[model samples]
Target: MVFKESFWTLSFDGAAAGGKGGTEIVLTRKSGEKLYLSYKLDFHCSNNEAEYEALIWGLIAAEKHSIKKIQIQGDSKLIVKQVSRQFVLKEPVLATYRTTIQRLLDKFQKFEIEHVPHSDNKFSDAFTTLGVRVDIPEEEVTIVIKKRTEPSIILENKDLPKDLREKILE
Candidate 1:
């Protein structure tokens, strides 16, 4: 069978705070397009469960998008190794997760999972920092849950004529 030349990149990260947890999935296409999804876990779960949920959801999304080749990355070493079949799963819950992930893996023409350091996975890290509240000095807690198509710093400001700018603004 001829393999496709295109591939998509997938990354996942999970965060837990005050008995609450969430997962983030970021998918990047070869054309520099990206899709980000973040969900807050309603039930109680450890960090590992959240990570697996992220991976599973990400894979499902790839299937929906008809992606045939994928390179998966995650900060969770155990989940990555287990999914890659490089490490044995000891926990029953994680074993179940692995089974689900394996079933999804069959849908792809080619796929690989790698363990990456948290520092190198800054985009996923940023998603985990969502839904967090930080106190600014003595003021109220500021909730930060940013979901943007482009990074705020890199956004381009097009200089349109005054008339056009006024019409667009209106």
Candidate 2:
């Protein structure tokens, strides 16, 4: 089936356990083609951090695909609200995440993000759960496994002062 115009749907979910985490991103084109990406975080982070990470990566993927319009769905209400400016951000780290997301959002001509029930977001959630639990494989799989050594925000903003960078890394 074809959409009226070029549009895409992006869904993301994140799972973290015992200082490790994983993020799953599903990008679907208007033509019904889907791309799945999963990432293993090598750094320690909270579940919220993982959610932000998933979102950042998902946007990056969509930008790479040259998508101009997108519909974003996630189960994290906090992340969605924070990104939408409905919630006040209290954490510095997440503030950084929000900033990064804002910058990425500017690349798209149109985009909308909404919170969905966990059950409604099961596909991405299930993939994220599996990504967090499974060990990295030696061979290739249908979904290529990627490793994130640090937060994407940190990686993107290298010009920050050393002290602030250290604090954010902590």
Candidate 3:
């Protein structure tokens, strides 16, 4: 399958506050077109988890767009190092995230991840911090929710909170 461009550039960032987190991704094509994605995670996650979610979600967006070669840029030094094989992931949760990211990246023909300073990644950082506040043009922004783990079946409908039960009903 011939692609329109030789490569795409993806910049990602994650932000966390009050035990909640958000992720943002910006994808730019060689032709100067751009796509923005942001996700609000319902589950509790650390800053590192947020970073991994950004990386993984960006890769998934690339795959969906039929992009084969890409450059990934992010502000998370630890995530960048682990993905680049420069550092080992000791935490079980992070290890799982790393594995998932690697699996998705394997689908690409060529991919490079680099750690950029936070200043260099201001666009994504702003979106992450804002969560879903600012709305981009409908064609440009994609919003999603990131659930790190599946919901447990152990909880019966009667045991779920009213709001959660209503969501399940939907």
Best by TM-score: 2
User: What are the RMSDs of all candidates, in order?
Assistant: 13.2, 5.3, 7.4
100-123, model 2: which lDDT tens digit per residue? 999999999999999999989878
In order of appearance, the predictions have TM-scores of 0.73, 0.86, 0.76
**By the TM-score metric, which is better: model 1 or model 3?**
3
lDDT of 3 by residue, 1-170 (tens): 98455789999987777766778889999889999877765557778888887787788788888999999998999999999989987887787778778788899999888999988878778889887344344355344533333222212335778788445422
Off by over 4 Å in 1: 1-4, 131-170
**Alpha-carbon runs more than 4 Å astray in model 3:** 1-4, 132-170
Ranking by lDDT: 2, 3, 1
Candidate 1, residue 81: how far the Cα is off, in Å: 0.8
Return the clash pairs for model 1, or none.
none
Alpha-carbon local distance difference test for all models = 0.70, 0.86, 0.75
Tens digits of per-residue lDDT for model 1, 1-170: 99556889999887666655666888899889988776555455667877887787678778878899999999989889888888888888677677778887899999988999988988787767563222123233222222222111111124556675334222
Best model per lDDT: 2
How much is 83 displaced in model 1, in angstroms? 0.9
